[model samples]
Target chain A: MSPETTVTFHTPSTLDEAFALLKEHGDDARVIAGGTALVVMMKQSLVVVDHLVSLASIPGLVGIDVREGAVHIGALTRHRDVETSPIVREHLPFLSDVYGRVATVRIRNSATVGGGLAHADPSQDPPAALMVLDARVRLVSPRGEREVAVAEMFRDYYETVLRSDELIAEVIVPIPSATARTAYLKFLPRNEDDYATVAVAALAEVANGTVQKLRVTLIAAGPTPVRAEAVEAALEGQSPTAEAIRAAADLVADAVDPMDDFRGAPDYKRDMAVVFTRRALERVLLAQG
Target chain B: MQLNVNGRTLEAEATGLATLVDVLRYELDLTGTKEACGVGVCGACTVLLDGRMVASCITLAAQAQGAQIQTIEGLGDRELLDPLQESFITDGGFQCGICTPGQLMAAKALLEHNPQPTEDEIKHWMMGNLCRCTGYYQIIESVANAANAARGDR
Candidate 1:
């Protein structure tokens, strides 16, 4: 057991109070939602803080609603909520599929989508899916609020552009076109409780039997979730045929620079990214048909 | 902090970041919830958080505040055991009993959520809780038997 330290815990009743706590504590305080990832890091002595402001007590931050033109998920919404959300199942099954496969049921029930994205683990599934979906995150601080694209939110390995005093309030995801199809695939040594060796999420729209638009993102193969623009370029304007998908998959091997580790070698992970991208594309294409 | 453990309310002094497993063993002296892997990966410290199975080793004690927590002590007394407990004893589901509490809690939670879980559903849901004894077949059968008992089938 680590030495006992005096750490103040503040559970604000409202968002304004939560922001005030963040503003008051600054770098000495950390916002805790679903402590799934943060608690583990704390136990490992990776991060130590004198104060923790829990966002779980804040109301209106645990619901998912699709209004107007976007799907808004509160920062405190758990992964299990996303996995079983009727709205997500009806409109964004790809996100649901990714959430269903994250960690395990125990973790999913407590791990929030905001915490997962804020942790910015390169091997995490949500960031890869959000990157491909071109999601936007809303950050709140005492000063004001600002929104940033998911792709730009990540700065490097296990790092995000989130400031110490800024808290992610919600994530706004633009609804995909009715013609669009998306899928997420990951490779892990064991099917349970293991991080992804390489994960791929692809979204594409087929029009007139030709690919009108495409987006591909790879995870665990780089410092952060990366958009495979080269692969997207290869697939756009091409027919949703096996040949086109194969060519797009081939482009991913060069687009990502994977690292060699116990999970797999760099070459193997890169090959897996290609294979996973191809399979995910094929699944989405067949679903459209 | 005051928590309703099993059926009784208890007050204890604990930090916000202290794990539920630590609260049970260290503060409350309910040592049934084992701590195998302190991380959430191992379900050896599984317990019921408001009747839902969760890895207590990873769950913060502060998170359990005002919530109902059920440990192995709440399952049954030595003389009178829950049906699931009886089933495990009869079906040889445990070898060393180190992971039994977690397994039973997870199985009990599964049964509560789904009375008649398919073998595949049980396998998929229980994948997070690992048993080094590798006696999953008997454990699954025990859970099924308990489910049957709960439904008045046996």
Candidate 2:
């Protein structure tokens, strides 16, 4: 049993108070919402913090709303909440589908969207889905508030651009066009609590039986979730035929630099990426039809 | 530190970093919440925090301060067990009973949210709580039984 350490648990009622607590504790503090990831890290001695600022008690930080053509998900909103939110389900069905496949329902009931992003795991499903959606994250500190593109928020493995005195306030995703369709696919060793071997999120607009615009993002294949530019480029101005989809999928596999791990070899992941990408694109095209 | 455990609020002199699992078992003498794995991977230390299931072993005691927490003890007693607890006993949901408390709590929360869940939904919801003793067939049956029992009561 690890010996208990002296720590302060600060519960803030508002965003301002939360930022103040973060500013006071700085590097010595860690913000906890669900504690699903951070707590395990603390127990393993991977992270040691003197202060834990609780974000669960904060108001207006646990909801999913649509405003001004953008979907705003509060930072403290639980994964389960987002998975079942009508707004998210109707507007971002791909995200809801990915959320349903995350960890487990119990963890999802406690795990927050911000914690998942703040943890910055390369293989996580939300970052991939959000990246393809071109989401923006709002950060609050004692100084003020600022927004950063989700694609730029990740610096490297288990690293984020958030300062110690900053807390992610919310994630904003612009509503997709009416002609657009999206899909997400995650390949895992098993179905439950298993990290993704390779996850893909694809969004495309089909205009008059041809692909007008496309965006594909791959997760868990590198240090950060990467946009599959080659695949997107290949899909542009092409029909949603099987041949075109296969060519785009091949481009994605060739573009990613996946590492070999205990779960799967690099070649296996690359193959699965191609296969899953084609399947996801097929599903989206069928839905559009 | 003070926390509302099971139902009645109690106070204890402990550090803020002490996990709720340690505080309940060691300090408050509520050893029902078992700690199979200190890590949150194994949900054997699950408890309800304001009607939501969370792994207590990973939750700090200070985090529970002034919050309503429900352990297995709060569900029922020997005299009158909750329907879910009764269903577990009737359906043979446990082979060793080591993971019973966590399983019961998780099932209880699932049924609370969704009074009638399909078999797939139950399995998906209960994935966090592991049971190596049983192949999880009986556990799923136990939750189904509990759901039926709750519906019958209504």
Error of 1 at A17 (Å): 2.8
Model 1, A1-289: lDDT tens per residue?
A: 3233466767899888987887887788888888888778777777788788888888887889998777899999999889999998887788888889898888887899888889898888888878778889999877789999998998988899998778898998888898788888788776556889898898888888888888889889988888899888887888778988898789888888887888888999988989998998897775555
Candidate 2 clashing pairs?
none
In model 1 chain A, the worst 10-residue window by lDDT is: A1-10
lDDT of 2 by residue, B1-154 (tens): 7789877988776785788888888889989999987877678999998898888888877777777999999999999999888988888899899899999999989888898989988988888888998999999998998898888942
DockQ of 2: 0.64
**Model 1 lDDT per residue over B15-86, tens place:** 867778988899999989899988888788988887767788777888888788999999898899999999
